[model samples]
Target: MTYDTFQPHPDLASLVKCYWTLEVPPAADSQRQRIVPDGCIEMIFTLGDDIKRYTSADEFIIQPRAMILGQTIEPFFIEPTGYVNAFAVRFYPYGFTSFVTASLHSLANKETPLELLFGDTPAAELEQKIIPATDAKERIQIVEEFLFTKLKSEITIDNIVKSTVGALLETNGVAPIKSILKDDPSKRRQLERKFLNQVGISPKQMGRVIRLQTALKMLLNRQSDSLTSIAYESEYYDQAHFNKDFREFTGINPKEFLGHENMELSSIFYAD
Candidate 1:
C-alpha cells in the first residue's frame, strides 16, 4: 500500500489540511482499518474499486466512489480492494460546510454521496478526473485544481461555524456544549441544530473525539508509561475516564489497542 499527503492551496490551507492519495498493489489485502474522528470532513474520489464500510463482521455498505464522509461519531471498519486508488480532501471542522447548501445535521454519521450535495453530473465529472490520473503526483495536482476551481468559488463559512470549531480545537475536543456557549445558551441549541446539519455530530461529541485523538497519538508514540499519566495529560478526569473515552472511540482499551495489528494501521491517522 502507498499513501501520500499534499498541501492544499494557500487560500484553503485553514479549511483543508491536505489532499491525499492511496494505492495498493493488485492482490494485496488491506486489513480492516479504523479511523477515529478528527473534527473534520473528507471528500473522497475513488480511482478504482469501491470500498466497504462495516459496522461489524457482517453489516456494511459500499461507500460511493465519490462521497463526503462527515464527522464520524463512532469508529467504523474499511475494507478496500487491492489496487485501491483514491484521492481525498481532509477538511478542518469549519471548512467543509462552507460548500453545503443543505442542513449538515442530516449528513452526520452518514456517508453522503457527493452527487447529493453537488449534483450528480458535477460529482461524476470530478470522480472521472481523479481516478484516471497517471500517478499519485498527478492525482494530487488534479484534485487541487478541481477543488481550487470549484470549491473556492462556492466557499462559505458562517460565524457560528467558525466559533464552534474554535471552541472544539481550543479545548482539544473536551469542551462542553454549555461551556462553549456560556455567553448564550441559546446559541448552544442553535449550534447543535447547525452541527447536526453541517457537522453530522453534536458539538459535544466532536469535542470528545478530538480529545481522544490527542491521547491516542501519545500512546502510539510511547510518550507515556501509564494510562493515568496519559489521561491527566489529555485532560480527562482520570485514568478511568481516559479508558472509557478510549473504548468509546476505538472499541478497545489502550493496552490492547497498542498491540493489535489493526491498531497499527489506525495509529497512522490517530497520531498526534
Candidate 2:
C-alpha cells in the first residue's frame, strides 16, 4: 500500500485540506475495511478496480467512480474488488458548501455522484480529465481548476459558521459551542440551522468527531502510554467517556483498534 498527500494551491489552501492519493496491490486475503467519520467531506475519483461499500452485514453497493462523500455520522465498511487506486480532495467542514447550492444535510452519511451536484456535462468532463491525468500533481491541477470555476465570487461561508468551525478546530474540537458564543447564547439555534445546511451536522456532532480524530492520531502514533492519559489529553470526561465516544465513531474500543486487520486503511489515514 502507498498513500501520499499533497499541499493544495495557495488560492485554495484555506478551503481544501489536501489532495491525497492511494495505491494498493490486490491482496489474497483482504478483509473489509472500516471507514469512520473524520469531520470532513471528500470528493473522490476511483482510478482502479471498483470498490464495494457495505450497506449492511451482507448487502453492498459499488461506490461511484466520481463522487462526493458527505459528512458521515456512523462507521461503514468497504472492500476493494481488486487493485485500489484513488485520488481525492479533502475539504474543510464548511468548504464544500461554497461550491454547491444543495443543502449539505441532504448528503449526510452517503455518497452522491458528482453529476448530481455539478450536473451531467460538467461532472463528466471533469471526470474524463481526471481519469487520464498523468500524476497526482496533474490531477490536483485538474481538480483545482474545476473547483475554482465553481467557487462563489463573494464569501459563501457565513461569519458565525466560519468562526464556530474555526474555534472548534483551533481547540482540536474540545471547545464547547457555548463558550465559543458566550457573548450570545441565543445564537445557538441559529448556528444549528446554518450548520445543517452548510456542514451537514450540528456543531456539537462535528466537535465530537474532531475530538475523536485527535485521540485517534494519538493512539495511532503511540504518543501516549495509555488510554486514560490520552483521554485526559483529548479533554474527554474520563477513560469511560473516551471509550464510549471511540466506540461510537469507530465501532471498536481503542485497544482493539491498533493492529486490527480491518483498520489498516483507517490507520494509514489518521496516522498521517
Candidate 3:
C-alpha cells in the first residue's frame, strides 16, 4: 500500500486541507478497513477496481467511481475488490459547503455521485479527464480547474462559524462550544443550526473528532511511548477516557490499532 498527501493551493488553503492518493495492491482475499470521522468532506475518484462500502456487517454498496463522501459521524467498513488506486481531496469541516449549494446536512454519511453536485455533463467531463491523469499532480490540477471555475464569486464560510471553528481547531477541540458562545446565549441556537447546515455535525462532535485526530497523529508518528502520555497530551482526562473515545471512533482500542494488519490502509493515511 502507498499513500501520499499534498498541500492545497495557497488561495484555497483555508478551505481545503489536502489532496491525497492511495494505491493498494491486489489481494486474493480482500480485507475490511474501518474508516472513522475526520470532520471533513472528500471528493474521491477511483481509477482502479470497484470497492464496497459496508453500511452494516453484512450489507454494502459499491462505491461510486467519482463521488463526494460527506461528513461521517461514525466508523464504517469498506473492502476493495482488487487493486485500489484513487485520488481524493479533503476539505475542512465548513469548506465544502462554500463550493456547493446543497445542504451538507443532507449529505451526511452518504456518498453522492459527482453528478448530484455538478451537472451530469460537467461532472462526466471532469471524471473523464481525471480517470486518465498521469499522477497525483495531474489529478489535482484537473480538480482545481473544475473547482476554481465552480466557486461562486461571493462565496465564503460564514464569519461567525468560521471563527468558532478556528478556535476549536486551534485548541485541538478542547475549547468548549459553550465557552465560545458564553458571551451571548442568544445566538447559540442560530450558530448551531448554521453549523449543521455547513459542517454536517454538531460542534461538540467536530471537537471530539478533531481531538481523536490529534491522538491518531501521536499514535502513527510514535510521538509518545505510552497511551497514557498520548491521552494527557491530547487533553483527555485519563487513559480510560482515551481508550473509550478511541474505540468509539475507530471500533478498536489503541494498542490493537497500533500494530494490526487490517489497519495497513488506515495507518498509511494517518502516517501521511
Candidate 4:
C-alpha cells in the first residue's frame, strides 16, 4: 500500500484541505475496510479496479468512478475488487459549498456521482481529463483548474457559517456554538439553518466529529499512554463519554481500532 497527500494551490488553500492519492496492490483475502466520518467532504476518482461500498449487512454497490462523497455521520465499509488506485480532493467542512448549489444536507451519508451535481457534460469532461493523467501532480492541476472555473459562478459560503466552522476547527471542536455566536439565540438558529445547507450537518455534530478526529490522531500516534488521558486532552467529559462518542462515529472502541483488520485503510487516513 502507498498513500500520499499534497498541498493545494495557495488560491484554494483555504477551501481545499489537500489532494490525496492511494494505491494498494491486489490481495487474495482482502477484507472490507470501515470508513468513519471525518467532518469533511470529498471528490473522489477511482483510477483502478471497482470498489464496493457495503450498504447493509450483505448488500453493496460499486462506487462511482467519479463522485462526491458527502458528509457521512456514520461508519461504512468498502472493499477493493482488485488493485486500488484512487485520487481525491479533501475539502474542509465549509469549502465544498462554494462549488455547488445542492444543499449539503441532501448529499449527506452517501456518494453522489459527479454528473448529478455538475451535470453530464461538465462532469464527463472533467472525468475524462482526470482519467488519463500520468501522475498526482497532473491530476491535481486538472482538478484545481476545474474548481477554479466553478468558483467563478458559485456563491461563497455565508460569513456566519464560515466563521463558525473556523471556530470549531480552531478549538479542535471544543468551543461552544452559542459562545461562538456571542450567545445570540437568533444567530444560533440562523447558523443552524445555514449549516445544514452548507456543511451538511448540525453545528454540534460537526464539533463532535472534529473532536473525535483530534483524539483519533492522538490514539493512532500513541501520543498518550492511556485512553483516559487522551479523553482529557480531547476535552471529552470523561473516558466513558469519549468511548461513547468514539463508538458513535467509528462503530468500534478505541482499543480495537488499531488492531482491527478492517480499519487498515482508515488508520492510514487518520494517521496521515
Q: Which segments of candidate 4 are over 4 A away from where they belong?
A: 153-155
Between candidates 1 and 2, the one scoring higher on TM-score is 2
Across residues 135-201, which tens digit of lDDT does each residue of candidate 2 receive?
A: 9999999999999999999758889899999999899898888888886879999999999999999
- Give the TM-scores of the predictions, in the order they appear: 0.89, 0.98, 0.95, 0.98
Q: How do all the candidates rank in terms of TM-score, highest first?
A: 2, 4, 3, 1
lDDT of each model, Cα atoms only?
0.77, 0.94, 0.89, 0.94
How would you encode candidate 3's per-residue C-alpha lDDT over 139-200 as one tens digit per residue?
88999988888887976678878878899889998998778887788988988888888898
* Candidates' RMSD to native: 2.3, 0.9, 1.4, 1.0
What is the lDDT for 10 in model 2? 95
Candidate 4 or 1, higher TM-score: 4
Q: Quote the positional error of residue 203 for candidate 2 in Å.
A: 0.4
Colliding pairs, model 1: 103-197, 104-196, 104-197, 104-198, 105-196, 105-197, 105-198, 108-200, 173-207
Q: How many residue pairs of model 3 clash at the backbone?
A: 0
- After superposing all C-alphas onto the true structure, candidate 1 shows an RMSD in angstroms of 2.3
lDDT of 4 by residue, 150-187 (tens): 88464578899999988998999999998999988988
Candidate 2 regions with alpha-carbon error over 4 angstroms = none
Whole-model alpha-carbon lDDT for candidate 4: 0.94
lDDT of 3: 0.89
lDDT by residue (223-267, candidate 1, tens digit) is 988888989988999888889988888888888888786675577
lDDT of 1 at 89: 87
Q: Model 2 Cα displacement at 68 (Å)?
A: 0.1
